[model samples]
Target: MNITVCNPLLRTPLSLIVDDSCPVINLTYYWIHQRHAWKARHQPNIAPERWEGDTIQLKKIPPTIPADFAWEWAEWCWENGVKGKFSLIPYPAGIGRVDEGFPDFPTREYQAWLRIYRELIWPSFDLTPEMLTHTAVVDLDTFTLTEAWEQVEWVDPPVDNRLTDYIIIAMEMLDNVGIPCEGVTSPGAFGKRQEAAYARAVLTASQHVNNNPRPFYFLWLKHDELPDVPIWYPDKEKGVAIASIVSCAGDWFGGWTGYDLGDADRFITEDLQGGCLPPILEKELPCVLVGHWPGFYFNGEKSGFEILKTVKARLDAYDPDGTKTLWMKNSEIGHYWMARELTKLTVMEEPPQIHLSTQFPTANFTLALDTPVRHIQVNGWDLREVHSRRDFQTDTFLVEGKQTFVAFDLEVGKTELELIVA
Candidate 1:
C-alpha cells in the first residue's frame, strides 16, 4: 500500500493508499500521533476520481476515516503476532488480454472502491510483516494464470527508460526530505552497444555536483529479449540454474544471453550480466523505493509481482522485535494459504568497524593495519569505508604496531565516542 519516492533516508508512514486495480481505500495505523505525514493515526489522505483521458491526476489525496471502521482490525493483526506498518490488501485479479475491459467494472465503481475503503474498510485492517519496499522476479514473458502485463509502448523497456524510473522514484524521495534533485527518464538507446554510453551519462550527471556524499541508488533493469540469467525455482529438485550474465553485474563475468527450456548448457557466454536490481545487487542501499500503482500489484506473484510485494515484504520485516504480518514473498505463498509473516527471523552481525583517520586532510595516509580482520566486506557507503585489520597487541616482539581496528568497535548510543589518531 506504500508508494515510494527516491531518497536515502528511510520512512515509515502511519498511513497509505492501496490500489487494487483502479484504486481503493487508504490504510493507516491507529493514530499514533507521531509523524506529520500521518494526520492523527486514524485519518488518511485519499485521491479524487479523475477523467479517463487525463494524463496526470491529483497525486495526493487525503485518506478518509470511516464511521463503521474500528481499531478492531489492529487487534487481529496484533494478536496474530502481526507487526509493522504494511497493509496487505488482497484483490481479485489476474492478467488478461488488453482488448478485454480492464478490472471488469464501471467507471463509477472505481469511485465506489475508494468509498468502501475510506468509509468502511481502511481503519479495520491489520499490519503485515511487509516493509515499505522489497524485491521479486516477474516472468511476464511466461504463461501464468494471471493476465499478461505487457510493457507500455512508450515504455520501450530501454536501459535509459529503466534508469529513468529508478531515478524519478529516488529523486522524489529526496525531494520529500527537502533535498533538491532533478533528472529525467530519457528514452532508451537504439541498440545494445549504446547502453554503456547511456548509463555513463545518467550517472555522471547525477554526480559532478553534490559534495556532501549524497547517496545514489542505481537500479539497472536489463531489457535484453534473450539475455542469459539465473533461474530460481521454489521447487527442491529445480535448484538455481545459470541462464546468462546480466549487464549490471559488470563485464567481469562477460555479457549475458537467453535460454531455451531444454537448453542444459551449464556455462555459456563470457559476460554474465549481473546486478540489475536497483542499487545493484549486494551493493548496500540505506533505503529502497517502490511504486504502489494498482497495475503493479494485481499483476500477482510468480507472474511479475516483485514490483509490489518483494519490496513490501523485506522492508516491512526490518525490525525483528516488531510484530508484522507474515506476507509471503510475491503473494507466491509456499504451499501455505495464509499470507506469510516476516518477523526478524534472524540477526545478522554488523560488519566490523574501520575508522579512517589521516595525519592531515591532505597528508598521504598510507599504512595497512593488515591483521586477520573478521568480515566479508560489504557496506561500501560513499561517505565512509570500513574494514577490519589486526594490529600488534603488545605481548612478544610483535612485528607490527601496538593497536588494531577491533579495539575501536562502536557501541550503540555511545555519544562522543573516542577514536585513535594516526
Candidate 2:
C-alpha cells in the first residue's frame, strides 16, 4: 500500500512571525537614536542617513506603544484564533531589564504590562527573546553593553560558547519574568552568517532553560520562493534539534518603524487572484506571514492592525470552513516538522500493517494511504473511523473517496497500525 505523510488534517499550515516586539517599548523609536550613538563610537564612524537625521520624525511616533494598545491587539488575536510567535526584548536597547523595570516607566505600570503579557499573550503565542538587547550586544562579564549592534556581533566570529552564553542570558531574562522561551528571534539579521553556530546556541540555551529538546528560531525572511518546510539542524546522536523557521512574506502589514503604511493587497488582494499567500497555499507550503511589532501600532494609527484584519478576512473568505488551512503556532510547526523528519515508517504486506517509530510526540498527526480501509488498529486498539475530516481526532481515521486518512496522537517509540482493507 502506498502511503504519505500529510499536514495536519490534510490542510496547509499557516503561521505568523513578528519581529522587534517588546513590552511597551517601541523599538523603532529607540533604535533610530541608539544606532546613531553606537555608530558615532565606531572607529570608522559608520552611520547611515536615517541615523544622521534629526528626531523630527519622532514627533509622529510614540516612544512607547503602551499597555492598552498591546491589550487590544492581544484580545483580537485571542478571538480570531490567530496563533504565532511574539518576541520580548529582555533588555530592549540596553534601556532596562524586563525582569527588573524600565527606568522611564513606573514600577506599577511595568509590572501591569508583564501581567498582561504573561496572562493574555503567553497562552496563544510562542514567546521568544529577540536577543538580550535588540540594539547593542551586552558584555556578560562587565554587565555592560558594547557599542557594536547585536547584528554585528552575530556575524563577527565563531564564538560558540560565548554565543550560547549570550542566548542563555536572554532566555533567562524571560524565564525570570515567568515567560519561558522555546526559541529565539534574531534581531536584524542576527546570526544570519553563522547559522549553524546560532542554531546550536539556540538549542543549548532553550533546552537548558525550558528543557525543550526541540527548539526553533526565526531569522531569514524570504519575500519570494519561500521554503515549504523548516530547515533542520539536528544532533541525532544527542536526540536534540533546532528548526530555522523562515518567514515567507514581506513585512507588508506595516514597516519595522510603523512609519511605512503597507497595503493589505500585497498579502491577499480583494479579488483573490494576486498576493503572496495564494501561491504559497497553491504549493501546499506554510504561509508564514511576517510583520513587526511597531508596525502593528502604525505610529498609533493602528493601520497595520487594520491591514492584518483585512488579510485575515480575505483568508477567511478563502478558507471559510477552515478545512483548507490549519493555524499553528511557530513552536507547534517546529515540533511537527521534527516528528515528520525523524519518524520512521515501515510497511509490511504479511498482515497489512504500518509501523511508526517516532522520535518526537506530536498532536493531530495525520497519514494518508492510497487504499481504502474498513478498520484500523493502533497496536491492537481499534481506532474509531470518523465520517468527516472536521470530526477527525486522535485514534480516528477517515475515508474519503479512494484515499484513507488516519489521525492520531503520535507517541514516542513504536506504534503498529494494523489495517483491514475494504
**What is the per-residue lDDT of model 2 for residues 19-126, given as tens digits with 9 covering 90 to 100?**
888876788888887766656666445536763333567668777888888889989988998888988999998888998899887776687689878888878889
lDDT of 1 at 381: 19
TM-score of each: 0.23, 0.95
RMSD after CA superposition, every candidate = 20.7, 2.0
- Tens-digit lDDT track for model 1 on 251-339? 11101100001110111111222223222222322111122222222111111122223333333434333321222111111111110
For model 1 the local lDDT of residue 61 reads 24
Q: Any idea how many clashes model 1 has?
A: 57
Best by TM-score: 2
**lDDT per model, in order?**
0.23, 0.83
Residue 173 lDDT, candidate 1, scale 0-100: 35
